[model samples]
Target: MSATGVVNVDDARVAYRLHGRGPAVVLVNGTGGGDGHWGDLIERLARSRTVVTLDYSGAGETTDNGAPLDLPTLARQVAAVSEAVAAPHVDLVGHSLGAAIATVLAAERPELVRTLTLVAGFLTAAEPRLKLTFELWRRLIAVDREGFIQILALTTLSDKFFASPLAAHLDALAQGILTGTNWEGLARQVELDLRVDIHAEASRVRCPTLVVGCAHDQIVTRARDLCDRIPDATFSEIDAGHQAYFEASEEFAAKFLTFADGLYSPRRLSSSVS
Candidate 1:
């Protein structure tokens, strides 16, 4: 928190949390995730690698500009984070919409990213059922605020994770969400995500990639489609739902470090992904 550099991206001065010391790994949160959302994962990854968490413009710490946002707009912010942290190349991990941003970044700015991880990512929306689900998500957020959050959680979380300790932590969830959520931003995010089709965009990613999916995920169900798109991608699934980062935090963190270590072999990784 001591005098970190800020880059003005349109209306938002992107805020990035930088810590540890080693090859940089950038953690990009989902559509509604703020900087703190990656706390559990970052804490574990930081033991051996520098981790930077960022909020996309109009998402969390970044300012809200009424300007229309798409994947391209978000990718620019990823570039900003990489430059601000002085990371010549970064291992980018993105969840939900952030995963899409990471895909675009790795594809377009290949030099900025060395390895990529996509969790519960919306890659191929060709399925009729998933397309319907995506549309329903859009409408819910546009109309019912409470219903949107409830359904959103239902789609992203697995039953096991919900029944676990996190089920009783609504206070923690609410607090974390309140950090950067507003009515307008929520609506805009819904609109942007529903409209995005990252299938064609994903094929452009050439970096060694890892795609994670949840068996019971309610939100983004195109995990298999995402796995198939990347040329050299490794695909796996966790028993938990879309919020795997929290329910299976330790597991996901281990997988993250392992995959990233494989990309940068100069230093061996000691963290566990299983």
Candidate 2:
């Protein structure tokens, strides 16, 4: 069984759902991602733990005033949902943009986050390649929506995935992206993506951290650099593209479960959560 609710944070109505029961684990989505992106991973995790998933202001069932998005505000929204769920501490698993948000939350309120996992995360977007990519994404959405979705699919998914049988569903995938997208919200998120810099916050995160990098990720290539910045953060790699969690769900879930369960030893242990 599962329960759902909404948390009013600032000008946004953050929608969240809770599944299964055990130690709490919050899954934070990346740019343009929502509850649906979790797919089978949610079911796998929910079998032995409480999984929390939510939509940011620009995605899914969540709604917010037409204002620009910022990291602190997004992190606060996640914090609000965490508080609403009545969990004393949670294991946060964030992807791409969500990883930066999770880092901010863990740094600001270390007591609320028991562990942190960053998948395909980057420290900053000021790099020329990333900045240009997001700028192009914003512009493409305005003049060519279909082109935008097609380009997104090409960049986020691995070539290996396309060669697989799943390639037959490309049309369905594109249609889903078109209907589910909130253009205005996504544009704001893209703007946020271009300006996000969590260098300061990454150093302040005081939880057992795992940074997972994707080998063929074209979107964010600084996952290794991010892992190096955090004190004693464990680093791992997946053989997939930007959407490693979705591309290699089983492997990602196994590594996540091991880390969250405190069964894996860290390369270097700087601090411990009590």
**Candidate 1: what lDDT?**
0.76
Models 1 onward score TM values of: 0.88, 0.94
In model 2, the worst 10-residue window by lDDT is 265-274
Q: Candidate 1 regions off by >4 Å? A: 1-4, 175-180, 267-274
Which runs of model 2 end up more than 4 angstroms from their true locations?
A: 263-274
Model 1 per-residue lDDT tens digits across residues 1-274: 2235567775667877787778888888887777556647777777888878876766655675677778888889878878888778888899988988899889899888888999988774546766687677668767776676677667777778667776897666765554446657766776777677887778888878899987778766768888888786889888887878877889998888777786456553432232
lDDT (10s digit) by residue, model 2, range 1-274: 5999999999899999999998899999998998767767898899988999999878888999979999999999999999888999899999999999999999999999989999999999997878888998989988998999888888888999899887898899889989889888888898899998999999988788999999999888889989988887999999999998888889999999878785324742543522
Residue 41 local lDDT, model 1:
74
Clashes of each: 6, 0
Which pairs of residues collide in candidate 1?
155-218, 155-219, 156-242, 254-272, 254-273, 255-273
Highest TM-score: give the candidate number. Answer: 2
Pairs of residues at least 3 apart in sequence or in different chains that clash in candidate 2: none
